[model samples]
Target: MAQMRFITALLWLLAAAPLAAQEDARPDLSIREPERGARARTYVLASLIYKDAEDGIDRFPLAVPELIQYVEDNTELDVRLRGEDRTLRQLDGITLLYMSGNNAQLRIGAEDRRRLGRFLQDGGLLYAEDVRPRGLGRFRFGDAGRSGTPFDRQFKELVKDPDILGAGGSRWRKVPRDHALYSSFFALPDGPPPGAHQPGTITDLEMLEYRGRVAVLFSDLNLTYFWGDPQAHSRAPSLRFGVNLLVFAIARQQAGPALR
Candidate 1:
C-alpha cells in the first residue's frame, strides 16, 4: 500500500513537471528597498561549508532574491536583499539563516556548532533543507539509519543536547497545522507546498522551539528549489510560506524574551 501511494504521487508530480517547467524563468533579481534612509532588516543566506561537500553551496541560486522580493512585496517591513554568504561563526547580527545543501556527509566543527547554538538562543532562526537528489542518498525520516546523508548526520549533531535550544532535551517535531507560522503572513491551510522531492508523503516542516519561539525550521524536501520562479503558479504558496517564516522570526525577536 505504501509503495502504491508513492508511485501515485510520483506520477502526479511528473504530470505537473511540464507546467512548472513552462513557468521556470529567471526571477527578477532587482531588489526594491523602502524609501526610508536605511533598511530595517536583513536576511542572511548562511553558506554551509563542509570538508566533504564542496559543491553544496551551488544548489539554490534564486532562493535569496526570491525571498527578498517576497518579503518586500507582501509586508511593511523594510527588508534588504543582503544575501552575503557567511560562515556560522559570522552570525552576529543575523536574524535568519537559510542553509541548504546536497552533501549528506557534511561536517562542521564543534566550535561552529556552538556558535550556531548561541545564535539561535539569541533569537535567531535557522531554516535548513537537504537538496540531495531523490534516489541518491537523500534523507528520509524513517530511513535515517540507511539513507541519512552527511548533511542529515551533521545537522542532527548540530542540534543535539547542550547546544542551547536543543539543551534540556528539546528536539524537532512536526509543526502543528494551527501553528502561527502557517498563518503568520499567509495562510498555509495545507501546510508546506508540495515539491518533486517528497510527493506522496506530506513533507513535515519540523520546528525546534525554545521558550515560546521557534528557533529552527527544517525540511528534508529541498524547498529552495520551490523558490525557483516567483511568477510560477505553483510557486506562490511556497514563496508565501517563506515570507511567513521571516515575519514570524522577526516578531518573536522583537517580543523581548529569548528563552522562556
Candidate 2:
C-alpha cells in the first residue's frame, strides 16, 4: 500500500503544519551565525551524493566545486560547501542551502523530513535543479537501452509535493526577463539579455516564497556548468546570469520581514 502510505503522509503533514508554523513563528530576521567555526562570507549547503538513473545521460549534475569557485570569483561572499557530518539541524549559521541537482537526494528520513520541510516553511531557502535527463525522442539510456538515461525521480517528488516545500502552486513561476539576472551588474553594455525562454523549454524550474522569509529557487539549466567552463569566462551574458542568481539568493535570504 504505497499509495495508502503516501496519502497518509500527506494528511499528516497537512494536519501538523499549522502547529509547527505557530511554534517557530519568529519575525523574519537574519539568522545568527553559529559559533562553532569561522564564519563564511556566505554558508552554502550542497547535497553532494548523487544516484544516476539507469539511463546513460544524467538527469542531474553535481557541480559543487564549480559553483563554489563562481561565488568566490564573482561575489564578495566566501561560500563553504557543507560536509555530510552535519545535518540540517546545524543550519543556523548558514545563509543559504544550494541543492546541487546532479541526481542529489535529501538524506533525511521520514521524521527528519518534517523538520526540513518546516525549515523551508519557516523561511529557509533551498536552491535546487534537475539537470539534463536521458531517454528522450531518440537517444536511449545506454547500449541497446540496457542502462536507462539519468532521471532525477526524487527531485520530481520534492517539486510536485506541496507538503514538502509548498512550491506546488501554479504561481511558482519562472524568473522572467525583468528579473535582475539580466541586469547591468552581470551583463556588459550592448550585450543582449538572456534570451526569452524557448517555448516549453522552461521545464521544472521554479521560484516561490514561503513564510515571508524563505524563497526557493530551482532551474534545469546548470549554472555551475556555465560558470565552470573556462571558455565561458568571456561569455559575459551567461556569466552575468550566473552571478545574478548567486547574489539574488543571498540578498533575498537576508532581507527582513517584508520579503516574500
Write model 1 residue lDDT over 1-260, tens digit each, in one string: 42233233333322222121123352333534324446555545454444554442425656767777766665555445466566777887665688776554546777877887788777677887766432354443222222256665566666774754556324768888877677655668888776545455546677776655677877775666657444445676677777777656555544433423
Error of 1 at 76 (Å): 6.2
Tens-digit lDDT string for candidate 2 (68-165) = 55556655433343323135555454445655434433445555556557656655666654443333454321222111113234554554455566
Q: Which candidate has the top score in lDDT?
A: 1
User: Which predicted model would earn the best TM-score?
Assistant: 1
TM-score of 1: 0.69
Query: lDDT score, residue 224, model 2?
Result: 40
Write down the lDDT that model 2 would get.
0.44
Q: Can you tell me which runs of candidate 2 are displaced by over 4 Å?
A: 1-42, 45-62, 74-90, 102-108, 133-156, 159-163, 166-171, 181-200, 203-205, 212-214, 228-237, 256-260
lDDT of each: 0.59, 0.44
